[model samples]
Target: MTPLEILSTTATGLGAGLALIIAIGAQNAFVLRQGLRGEHVGLVVLVCMLSDIVLIAAGIFGIGEVVQAVPAVVVVIRLAGAAFLLSYAALATKRAFRPGALNASAQQGSLNRKVVLATVLTLTWLNPHVYLDTVLLLGTLANQHGDLRWWFGAGAAMGSVIWFSALGFGAKLLRPVFAKPGAWRVLDGLIAVVMVVLGVKMALGI
Candidate 1:
């Protein structure tokens, strides 16, 4: 590929990944919450970006095809991921409705790095859509160039890194917005709607 073509391909890859991630979801919510609170910003961003890289790389390396071929396994994952998504959505909605401290970062509890890590890990790995995007969609598209597959993968990984870093840090600028009580409600509610819709779509094969 020419330099210009390479740039174009990488840009396209970045756009594709960003399209999937820009919407409100568990990952975004967690990252935004951390950014707004100025807590564990680096940890949250690193986990999210690394998780995407690993998942996307695995997808490009034929692992995704193997997993997709196993219908039984895929179906099980679809169901389990659906359950997790819905549960998260429910929790978010409840939080949105309840009267609580606005600054969750100030809550009386450990940051729970393990809990946060596990949540993103599960959401990244278990969700069938994640596999479909990284493995089936992006992988197939990347394979079109045969020897240049790695370039496509590189583009996607770059996108992931850029996105997580931005979402984590960029959200900090919105601290005043998120700090307002109404902002949390709006944010959490939007996330809840996104999660529940995504969960049902996966469960119902939409």
Candidate 2:
């Protein structure tokens, strides 16, 4: 591909990636929470970006075809993700009912690093939508660029990195607002609603 073609392909990939990820979902919710709490925010961002890169690469390598071939894989992932989301929603609901202190240090100490990392991985990897966006959709779009597919994937990966970094770091600006217990309660309530709604939708295949 010529330089101009490459740039155009990469830009398309970037826009597509941003469009896919910049939505209200479990992954973004968790990242936002971590950012607001100032706990392992960098780690969360890194995991999300890396996971996207791997999935995007797999798509560029034609794993999307395999995924499309096995419909059961998507179903299983959807069910698992749905269960996780529902459980998390329950937890969020409980938190909303009795939100404890909103101090970052107070809550941050309760979450262990390993647990945070595991949660990040689960949120990123277990969602069927992630596969749809990064693997199936983006992969198919990248292939339209022919030999420039890898470049497209690279651009998508860059988009993921930019988004996660911005989300994880930018949420800190809300620290002052979230410092109040009421703010945390409201946030948790919203999270619970989002989680439950998404979970139900996934379970029903709607």
Candidate 3:
């Protein structure tokens, strides 16, 4: 493809991705929490972006097609993802009701690098909706560009970087709210509701 075509395709893909990922969800909430706590926001953003790049690249190379053909894999992922989401939702609901504030410098929870990596993996890879977002939707939209598929993928990847960085930083704005016990309760409740609803949708295959 020509230079102009590549630029156009990438720009289109970026726009599509930004539109798709603006909603409040588990990933967003987690990143925001970390950011507000001033706990490795850059690292969180890096992990989120890198993971997205891998998924988007895989999708561009036909991972989506393979996944579509594997009905059993799809079912397994949906079931597992739903279970996880529901569990998380329950925990969030409990947290919401619990009268306690989140200490930003809480020396209680350990944040080892390996644990952090695991956290990113579970949040990014293990989430079923992420597959549909980066793999299915972005992949199909990117493939529409004929020979400019790479450009589209690049743009989508860039969007992921921009988004996670912005989200992680923006989350700091909520530090005051997150510091309050009631605010945490409310946030947790919202997270619970969203997660449970999404989990139910997945379980029902809707």
Over 4 Å off, model 1? 1-8, 101-111
lDDT (Cα atoms) of all candidates against the true structure? 0.76, 0.88, 0.77
All candidates: TM-score: 0.85, 0.95, 0.87
Best by lDDT: 2
Candidate 2 C-alpha error for residue 59, in Å: 0.5
Ranking by TM-score: 2, 3, 1
Backbone clashes for every candidate come to 0, 0, 0
Q: Which stretches of candidate 2 lie over 4 Å from their true place?
A: 99-106
Q: Which portions of model 3 show Cα errors greater than 4 Å? A: 102-116
- Tens-digit lDDT string for candidate 3 (48-155): 898889988888887988878887787888888788779878877776665453432342243666766566666666677777778888888888887888899999
The residue-by-residue lDDT of candidate 2 on 43-69, one tens digit each, is 999999999999998998889999889
RMSD of each: 2.5, 1.4, 2.4
Worst 10 residues of 2 by lDDT: 99-108
lDDT of 2 at 180: 66
